[model samples]
Target chain A: MSATRVTTPVQSVDAQAEWELAYRSSKLRDCEFTTLSGTPLKPLYGPDDAPIDPARDLGLPGAFPYTRGVHPTMYRGRLWTMRQFAGFGSAKQTNERFKFLLEHGQTGLSTAFDFPTLMGYDSDHEYARGEVGQVGVAISSLEDMQTLFDGIPLGEVSTSMTINGPAPILLAFYIACGERQGVSPKDLRGTVQNDILKEYQAQHAWLVPVEPALRMITDVMGHCAKHVPQWNTISISGYHIREAGSTAAQELAFTLANGMEYVRRGQAAGLDVDQFGPRLSFFFDSHLDFFEEVAKFRAARRIWARKMRDVFGAKDPRSWMLRFHTQTAGVSLTAQQPENNIVRTAFEALAAVLGGTQSLHTNSMDETLALPTEKAVKIALRTQQVIAEEIEVAHVADPLAGSYFVEAQTNRLEQEAETYFKEIEKRGGVVAATEAGWIQREIHRSAVQYQRALEQGTKRVVGVNCYQEDEGKGPQIEILRIDPNVEREQHARLTALKKRRDAAKAKKALDDVRDACSGKDNLLERFIAAAHADCTLGEIADVLRERFGKYKEPRIL
Target chain B: MNDQKIRVLVAKPGLDGHDRGAKTVASVLRDHGMEVIYTGLHQTPEMIAEAAQQEDVDVVGLSILSGAHMSLFPRVRDELVKRGLGDVLLIGGGIIPGDDVTKLESQGFAKLFGPGTNTEEIAKYVIAEMARRRAATGGRR
Candidate 1:
């Protein structure tokens, strides 16, 4: 809704006056011209908007600051990993889906655990009714984990597990699964979404309170730095934070703040930043704002690189690189006229690549209604493949580098994030602010702002708010329905596993885990040993809950 | 018409933590001049029912994103009936399919809003429904 003509039309020259007269007389549609996050944009931009110094702000890719990208060649060297997160039903069913993805040319594996497992509950736990395999694969034991990666090679394929609250337990099961495949932890490459601060602030999944969760993360960091060298111990995520309704700037600010807290924790535990820093990665949501999303990624890199090198005093270049994964915004998809989501996802995927992500996941068309069907998943994957193979935009690094609008947006987001960092520091760090409900309140405020705009018709979402469409016009799309029997079958597996396991050994190892939670010992060793002793995820999490107590969120608006 | 302010309890009745929609609707209903009570995450059916009874709310809205509504909504509904609050409007939302929306609407659900639903619409629906129910019951408490 902003006008860009600064000079008076009457006093301006002939061309300017004529154009201004035409613009004033023409009927412009009533809509707000802004980014997806409500950032106002002018009709046109000039040199005055962006004054970027290339050498200092954005050095050559892989050089100091690393603003442009992490690598010198970028996609010229390798395309971003087309990692569609696929998990539903039991482990065997999810395994078939994984293999099907691999056969269809997916680059990496991204496993999504069901909500029960995400909350550290077994399939048969009382809290897990009707939710065993609804959203993702229901994994309860090492047997389930083993079946998940049955034929997939642990040595070759890199897998990323989206688990946070019980990250150490899941990683232990994964490590033991690899061991059975004759692959030591040294060769296993993947990422575990071990970030817990966002869980407290947004996602609402947690195994323990703030203090114990940070301890578990640092414990996993220490172990993975030595044995699981290739493993990304923590994917400091902004994805869920955004999904929970945050602006792009809040997403970057809160994500990197939590990341800084992790660095502080590792340093407090006497671990070097360079030791665990390179293994630390990030995950973000690519919303519908093309230039703004690209700028956010660039700003994320520059901020993290400067913090790692200057603030943390890490000398390794690897530690300075801020590698990240990106997923198209699930909140952007609509249930009405769902086919339009394919185009939305394609554009968002293009933004991720232009933003220089190491991996990307595109949300399926029908995901607004259910977990994507096979055809929907294929279309989502093909969107990425089309971007990788057919699109020539990736041949250059940070292709939007010098664009006036893009650079200006990048600087704007960076400054806003810095302001937030100071505010977070004023309230303490990420964990303390989260505990005080400051971060949650801030994110929810922006979410409500966006929703208000959408309702007011200022921000138009095609097929949702603006375009008129009848439901009977188009053919009904098939939706994926997880069989209700999956829960029954999962409960049966858990029952059989409990009967088959060595009860005494599991009890003793789980007791060790409980003791380890209280002591100064690293919890991962106990977790791995417990995994070997056939302990279920629920058993170990139950012990941790007993030792660490639980977290109660302070109510906020 | 009775000048009673519509009382509403927004409940997240399952393990999922997606409270954006719940909180947004709660805020919008509050804006529309309704008394609102929000039950935070991880509340069982009995807890929701007790909260509704204690608060004396006219409507109980359940928000669950984990696809547990078939089991959860009925359990909460039965618990409300057990507590003798069966007539309270029981509405909900999540990633529910169109078929499930029809099925649940037929099976004692007031209404089920899905993704992309405007919070204002939810508020208007509650106000109108409460007025209609009160008029039908001859304005009895």
Candidate 2:
């Protein structure tokens, strides 16, 4: 194997002597200086590091195998959408926050749901007693969803909802809200994080079992293809995977593996490749590792484009694009010196832009302390603006494309991801691997290793491991406090809505949804009908839970 | 031999679903010679209290990030008290504000670990609390 490949010897004796002299004179920290994944880095990179045929490997942007970018002009034509993720308290409260963001020059709206809503429960559910309007906004019924986007024109604004377990019902609620606003389904454009495979692997917010979940996702794909043509039915996500502790290469490989699984399932469901493929999108995490994240994004686009065009035989060029939204790493934020997180988020957001993200969400500085206040959210939005208007990094497409270090890192990431794909294939695909606990174990191992490094002082997190600060001496920042009355108000509103809605019609619609779950009918239409009948989210989820059953995650540790 | 193990029930109360902190803490506790039982995500207060009783854990750690600590933590504490397991140490972590931490401690929580808390500090607190409880109970274990 070694004889078959070309080898380059280190022939720069003068450079080596210079490096040794500097190394001997300088006093360095007693820790390993490497990438986030422990990949050793050299002081300098040269042509030998990434020997590439530019014509073959480094193609132009918007061409086949789009390694540089998916668009011809990238950010020069139109800036990447400055979508700020905002939500908290009740629908009315979050609606105010949404309007505030839009007024402050936010280009798009990305919603964050409260815990009960994310877990597919109503505010009044016994299990959802204490957690109604915390973390994010609470949307239980069509009424809540309507109020959540009351004045915002659905046709004019693009919205992204980050909910997974009950994504279909939430999407239905959103469509119903749009229709009430006189916006046709075809005019509505947005994304729903309907990526359940990642839920089982990392995020743990899944509804039914694996087969039923995939079936429902395929149903959404087909349903949107015919009716909601502009809607992105699924945002296959790697954000949660990276936040859960996977490395850059693992995030790229596992996310693309999940994306391919969705593609295969769509094909198996008899949908044309181009019909549903164009609407497929992705979500990733921009962590503290700058070059590694940029490389991960570049490698993701190239691998996805090749697989879609060659392996899957996608004919449309739009089907080959791998557009993604990025949110700065929430796990990277610290509570000790909370203001330091502002600098961290700015760096991560800049890396996401340089890597050519279509949309971005910069996490608020106080997130590690609590949900972000309005003031903190505005600062976070300004971070993105400074990168776009002031920094001027988006003036060129793939600005670091030809750099020796970045190109080499991108190529190395691609090779590592390909190796992961082979390993996953040997374990019988992503779904099988997840079920067998292989994928979860891999993420767990990486997480443990990273945490161990942090504990052992190998990694330096400012204000955490190195910069010691007394508890009372740190800067005092105001934290957002969710009103305790929010839950009571939400419960009352849910009660009023339930009483006013025609019980027989809602019950019949829910029964229809349950019937569809048992048969081969697409569940999206039934779910929309149930949404029209004013069925609560928990009601819809409970109907399916009776037939398909909930998913019990396998123990990986 | 069974008494030598410091059994701990680690649970996520409510619907946060971000388990990096919980799992990492579980691993750290296990590494520190404690038997950790992780109950996974979206566990209600009732489920957590019941697990603490069934596992007979020396400590109950509730990891909440949804800012529902004021409501959820008290429920877990009251549930354990109702079950006559008030002697079991109750601890919490994850994104809780300083004011709420003071209130939670006042409500009988042994410790409220916030973000950036060192894992060694948590292990030390748990071990010391268990030893203190054993001494008070006449070393029943």
Candidate 3:
């Protein structure tokens, strides 16, 4: 409508006094001025509000304590990977989807397993009843893994698996699958959501107790650093934490603490920080809070760099860089008006790019009702493509770096995260604090508070709170339904595989897995053997569970 | 007429770990003066029925987000029938679609709320239903 209206820089004190005088007489809308988390906000932030010393705190891109960004050229050098999480039904179904995504210009692959597989149950297990390949693909053994990536060349593409409880088994399956395709372990590239502490803190998927789980993580990190050099052994994630309803600051604080705990554990297990550290990556959620989410990402990099350098004493610069993958907030999607979620995802993805993430996944609009249809997933992907091609935001690194609002929010988040760190330390460590339900209670408090605000009309969520939509009046979206036949087919396939595989080899492999759990041998090394011997995921996980024991979560309000 | 407090057991009856809605609903129901018992996570259908019988709960609310409702919800309702807790109202909420919600409602599920449902509405509905059921049944044992 109009060209930019430029303004001259004014003195901080004089401008504030003038603004304050006008604000007293001027009428304002009756609304809250705080952040989504209820953090108090200033009307207008100036240079004085941002007390950051750019030299020390905001170094140039690719420099020490990379608050600006991890790369010098940023997206100019390479655009952030557009990797969408995809899976459902059998491995055959998901494999077709994988090739479909790759053909459509998706840069990387992120796999989602079904609830039964995520919880380490086979299709035939009693606990797996009614849950085979409902949420994601069911990969019960090496045979399924091979079929899942049948035509795809592992040496060329990087895969990210969203598996935690049974991460080692899945990783071994991938390695064995790669070998079948003539890809060596050294040539393999990808990451696993191997951060187990968060399983207790938020995402409640785990096979063994905390102590044994932590041990398995250390074993994976140690083995991967030497063998699969390009593989990121762990993606310490805050995505599930935020999805579980933690505030932006809590998500940042808890995730960094988990990362530090891994470093501590790896060190204690006689592993070099520089060796495993460079491959350590992060995954975060890009929530609806625009400035808060951006600042959370910026502060995350700064806090992680400082922790890696000063606290852990890692000399390698790569080890200090906090590389992360982000996914848009799924909880923010309103099922009442499903189409509005596309706009929500677009804004959240922009925040991630501006905040400088290495990769991103935008949730489909129809995700809240069920797994997304093909059209929904495609639109979600195209949202990112348009942002990258249509918008000019990608040209600049840390584009919002100098804005007083962004810097202030970033500084405040860094300080808030530090306060949580001290509290977590006071309770021994991340494990002890999580075990005691302190972290969960904090998350619950935030979640309940948000709910209260939404109910009270203090927080306006378009379809839910403010703009009312009559029931059955809005357009209905077609949802993808999981075939009931998927379960029976999976069961038959598992039974047939069990019938054909050598019984002695499978049993011996499982016995070795059990021994590895009790003895000093690396568990992943034994897992690879089990994968070679055609051992099922449940077969190996069952042995590990028996040896390592099960974890019973402490109830939290 | 005797006054009987509304007792609701908010159970997570599947492998899904999404308890945010369940926990928030439990907290909200308690604020509205209802006795709320939450069966934390990863409870099977049989375990849910057993918990309801042990707690003698008036209502059982299951929250499942893993898309297993078609297979799981019926089994829970059946288990309740087997345990003689058939009078217990069964309701749920999750990522369930419209067709499935209609189908579930026909199968004895009192009402199933989906995402973006107001907790206040749930509380008010529970209270009203408890009153209507209590009046029709004469009195509780």
Candidate 4:
């Protein structure tokens, strides 16, 4: 009676609109569509559909809140630098591949160190067996580093080393090697996968415990800021996280959270945000969900910009910028119908380009079987080139920016990721969470769910669960064959290098590294000095192991 | 199939950080009612062999993606024999080539599995092989 007496036109209009929409709906196969993160999607999008504040959320490319890209021109000015993850056998062999990739138009160098090198052991060390130059080129000392980049100019080409626990020593080796090549650390431009937190969460290449690892990372940050200003002390990576079976949102959120933690450590170490943040970079995995991957990248830029500005109080625009390298997901590739991997890679690469990655590494078709052959590697490189040249997808910035679905999904994903970040913080940071097995358990639970879905044919992987042919049967794809003798040859080279080096000098250099590790001294500085003394990687590794000791992971399962 | 559990030792022999596959395989094998002893990250050949001997594992499953498979597998094979564990089936997995697999098998490593190898098949093989080995050993355990 009261409503009838005072009924407003607004109330009647609202009721009429609701009734019209409720009656107008027609039956379809499925009424609702959504992203994995539970973001609602409409059937279409237009210029008027986006809910973004242009100046606040997504400014111009290269501006604050760089949702479009970190650079104004982006790929229009230069296509992403194609860097293939290449290494195996000896430094001589990997060095050859380096030249090959460069000659074939690889703009950056990404080094994959063997187990022993990564673990800080020499080729002759008992633990070094089977691993020397098997997974990557073994660089045990300055001699190996020198051989690794022998013909390649360190002064010009930016190099990224996928080493963590011993990243400081490796950086020192590179600096010393650079000195030998008449290059200085100041002029070098590259990254050290010096992200130790992710090491605990995703990759298990950690040498020391979390506390020392954080210190080592900060040491690089301080040293690189002062000396190697052009170098990125750490490449905050989500590649391994995704490869370890994380969803896209987890990868984005966890990686940025790790990046924030690193920044906090750097600040605590007395380094200014502006001093080190400009050099901070990221490495992401471009998964099979093309649009999702693209949305993830755009959302990453928006989230990082907001965090750097509001949370960390970053002043410089460069401090807020997120320049990242994208690598197509290796876990996505199937060993069945190996050639189909090429198509998957192409699509992934296209997503990366559209996502505005600063650089890219497309997974080779044969990598699921073995380290890629030169021909297969070339196809991967060509995949990027074709996307940049032939495909006109990069003409516009955030081409899908205003698309209602993408914009809404991006927001939803960013929100989900933020929730995860809060959860990680509540669990006492990523390292603590990992130590407590919370992070591992979460990943394990998700992995189990995904596998169960696959098993039950709920998730359709084109060639896998459904439409499986012969179920793991196929004509074997051509695998990149490595010579078994490479290990023997690497051993001989290590022996010869040891025989020729000044034993006293090498011993002293290693002693310095051990002293540094035992004390609060910068390990990178001593490592550089050791490299000058021509100490082998194994010698340096042994010294550090004696002082810092190897990490023993707490078993979750 | 009320058989004795298959004791499988899952080992990472090198510094390569990729272990999802290894962990997944271990979990799957355990789900299939096998006892899996995972020697945590960065294990050497000596450690792997010692673990196998201590655990009295029926199978030693080595996962190496860091391309150190050739050096790692052969040395593990040698160590197993050195430790009088020649009875244990030394299997290999992860990014290994066909030709190298042949060479490794010739050198007495058990069968090689690649990227797409089924978790079920791995579990079944380990269970069946362990049963056979137990029969030969007169079921002392």
Candidate 5:
């Protein structure tokens, strides 16, 4: 050891100097806080930051351990579908919006059924009253389905229906409508949000108990796996979980737990993972945290991949690839300074894109105020376009690849989510947690925390809390106001459709649904047959509810 | 004067299904001493009123956000009058339009609060309004 002690020139720069140069005039920055799930984020990250195995964790895209992106050339080959979720009033009105969106260069379609249809009420039913078409399209029967897809070629467009509980009935009607259009069930390419676990956890839209609801979900999964192989049977959604004020990590943990439960149910039904798992997809909410949302998606992909491969023994790569659809977080939209929502949406949309989403729906600026108007919706869609075409974001895959902050966050999120997964498993998985209201309590705790933060000004929402303007508030953004007359029109259509359909045939089909639901027979097949016979959604639901009995949530506060 | 019971109808108007706040509010209100009639989830305005009338409530609270509250709340207000229950105070909450708050109030909405509103204020408002209504109606007959 020659004690050379050669004094080398000061290496490059000190940490503070580098930070100042990198972040621009940063004082000795304050200590950064950990994520909600206690994931520490360093003030910086670099190539050697992530504690991930190169061969095991950072696998190539379209291969095992997909970290770069899901597909080889995600946007270079084809952009994610720009599916604007539009529906209100009646099927006729929603059909018009669908046609309009298509004419405006929208690729895929998403239908938002109203509460009545979601809860399985026909428009003519007494429970429907003011809710028939307030939130989304009203589908009382197969006739409404026909009208919804009228003029819009169902064979050409892939439609995603955001309905659960009654998802099977709606899917049945969709298949029947497609049959009338000269299309076979095997040719249909679309998705049904048949995930009921999230409903129990975050949304509370359960129409039946856990066992029966799972039965209905398995029915859809088995039917789609066998018949409509091109369709995604379920979209395990974390969007509502996040929207319900859950942290990004909670959304990931809870959603994956729900997805795993569904997979277990599907496997219990004797479907091979390779056969049914490929059709399993996900839906997520891209929130305001740019890097956090991106990391959430990456962490989600890794989690799902590992679970499918190691836990579920899914051999097929396609089964491991967690294909997901993302929507900008609606809760992140601000009612104050609404235009700021446009910027927020742009960043959220970018996060989704960079997160390797297969499909995305950006919320319009005015969504916080009302249903997005046509102008605002166009702008929202254009936000995605500008990012894809103008911003050159689509050119590179995982643009934030190897970034210090993102990598650390990704690792942290993965760890936190793994812990949550274990806890859920210990709690007897999703069903047990939901039944015991554990998941719900967790969501409530997180929501209360987030709300308290907003109330206490710990988190600054630009126009909502900070920078409050008293007079001459920002430009009044035009909100989409659904015409009230549409209700009367839909009611009239319901009356006419009820009068015109074959009463005896409808009654018989409903009887079949009831009989199938009451027994162990696959309700999907029976529901499909009933849909062909023009049995309205309400009629079918009435029969199922009469047998299944609705879920009365235990008082859990 | 005797303490008047604060009547509240927690409802979900649109397709959004997060009812933790609604249920939590109902429980807290009950604990804070209010007669809360939770309409459960996915309740339309008609169901809300049917519950309101059947329960003989004094105030109706609407929790909606799926961007349908603008059209949905007005319809609820009109139906409340149609059922001859217009005296019931209509309060709107959840993610509502700020400008539309005045519009809804002008259309006979008593109060409007978005997220982050103090639950105590809500409870106190309901109690005070019920007391005022009882006084106005000459001790609820």
Candidate 6:
């Protein structure tokens, strides 16, 4: 055997020496030169930084191990769905907002339910009294869901609902809404954030226990496979985890881990991997670090594609694609200098686009103050338009493919995520790890570290730690204020609906839901029947909550 | 000898599931030598008031980001007042507008912190307010 040695090129060595000499003589900012996740950065990246294999790591777009992109033509074929996550006040008001966005060129619809609906509580429930229509629209029954999509044709438009704990019930209501619009389940297209695992790990919006929630998610997957083929049963989300203070790699690892766990559960439930896997989607957060966010998205695709094909033994190329929706990080928005959020959101959205997202939501600048007003939402939507039309970023796919820095960061993220996967496996997979509060503690540790860094000025959030200004004297921007009467009106409407509906039929539907929850019958079918029978979301959820008790998050420090 | 710590009951007293702020504040309070009791999600005003009374917390911090402060905060305050624990130093935080802050303050809240509020400021304010209350009550109740 012959021994081989590698050495740096003479010219490259001389360039490195000159670079070190210049670095020693020049002044640099006295701050950590690292990514938000603490990945160290050098002054420059040469070929030595990352050795990329063109045929292996950097494969062609739309091919197996899709690191570059999921689609071949990418944006040139079709721009990402510009979905603005808008919901607030009553269903009527939010419906008006939805129409407004659609009129202004929103390509998709994303609904954000109020806390009551998210927690599977009726608007008139005592626990939901004050919070009827605060954060998002309060949809207690199919009536509210119907009002939420009043004039908009559900068949023509794609919708995404960001509800986890009550995801099945919400999706049922949505399917019922579609039926009212003369849209069959087969033609309907949308996604439900049925990613319950993340709720226990980060969001804390979970309703049922872990085992029951998994059962419900698998039930949805099976039902959608047979019924709503185009519908994404679960949008495996990292957005909430990122908002909860996880680093970029942590978000990627935890999100993909949850996705794989779902795949495993589906397989365990005797469902073919290809049937359900193709419809599974992902949701990610685009934060301030531009290159890091882009690299994270790239790494996510490569990892998912490889895992789905190589590990899961999936033959379908569609199942290997990591289709994701990106939202600009809400945690990155600042209240100190509220207008600065506009710039932050623009860069973040651009990163998502450059990272090859299938859809994107640019957060409104005034979200830190309150729910976005019409004007603020218009600007947020216009940010995407500017990126698509003015910026012309969609002219080519994977523009940053060969950049040494981006590739190195992508490799680093992939490696870090693999390490986390191993650690999570050691802790007995995602569900067990989540139940034992390990995942939450890991996220909390990063969150605390990041908060400490921000407090100590090590992390320079513009207009937060560094660019100080008196917010009391800043330009007063108009903020959206939900009318206090929205709650009263929604409660009254719910009462009126209850009076008009068939009480006995609703009771029977809820009983059937309980039966389905107890037995092996598909819960989605029962939920759909309940939605049709005018049983409120809280009713269906309560029936299941009775059988499978509510989850109390373990106290993790 | 019993250990002395500033006991705080950090509760989310509404339907809002956004707990990033609440968890961060709880951690900060705990780090600053305060014993934080975080009653997880979906706590009603009655539940919060009962927990505060039972835990005997020196401070009650309600985190409401769902724009229901006008309705929820007053209910919590009324519950605490009805329970004869009005001196529990009720404070609030979340995506609250300035106008609502004034309204909540007039309704017996100590102060309302908004987004981007420093944890140190919150910690310092709690300590200072507790000391002031202690001084006013002659170090009793």
lDDT (Cα, 0-100) at A443 in candidate 2? 89
Model 5 chain A: weakest 10-residue lDDT segment is: A1-10
Off by over 4 Å in 1: A1-27, A472-475
TM-scores, one per candidate: 0.96, 0.96, 0.98, 0.89, 0.87, 0.96
In order of lDDT, best first, we have 3, 1, 6, 2, 4, 5
Q: Where does model 3 exceed 4 Å of error?
A: A1-12, A473-475
lDDT of 4 at A137: 80
| Native contacts matched by each model | 0.63, 0.70, 0.74, 0.70, 0.30, 0.77
lDDT (tens digit, per residue) of candidate 3 on A1-557: 23211223746888778889998899988788888888989888876677777767888899978999999999999999999999999999999999988888999999999999999999888988888889999999999999999999999999999999899999999999999899999999899999898989888988888989989999999999889999999999999898888889999999999999999999999999999999999999998889999999999999999999999999999999999999999999999888999999999999999999999999999999889898999999999999999998899999998888999899899999999999999999899999999999999989999998888898899988888778692338888988878889999999999999999999999999988887989999999999999999999999988887889989895
Candidate 2 chain A has its poorest 10 consecutive residues by lDDT at: A1-10
CAPRI-wise, candidate 2 is medium
Better of 4 and 6 by lDDT: 6
Runs off by more than 4 Å, candidate 2: A1-28, A473-475, B1-3
Better of 5 and 6 by TM-score: 6
Model 1, span A1-557: residue lDDT tens = 23222222233478666877887899987878888898899876655577677777888888879999999999999999989998999999999999999999999999999989999999999889888888899999999999999999999999999999999999999999999899999999999999999999989889999989999999999999999999999999999889888999999999999999999999999999999999999999999999999999999999999999999999999999999999999999988889999999999999999999999999999988889989999999999999988868889999988787888898899999999999999997777789999999998888889899989988889988978587752228998888889999888888898899899999999989988987999999999999999999999999988888889988876
DockQ for each candidate?
Answer: 0.63, 0.67, 0.73, 0.55, 0.31, 0.68
In terms of lDDT, model 3 sits at: 0.91
Clash pairs (backbone) in predicted model 2: none
Clashing pairs in 1: none
Interface RMSD of each: 2.1, 1.9, 1.6, 2.2, 3.8, 1.8
Model 4: per-residue lDDT, tens digit, A259-286? 9999999899888999999999999999
User: Which sections of candidate 4 miss by over 4 Å?
Assistant: A1-50, A466-477, B1-6, B56-60, B74-92, B100-112, B124-141
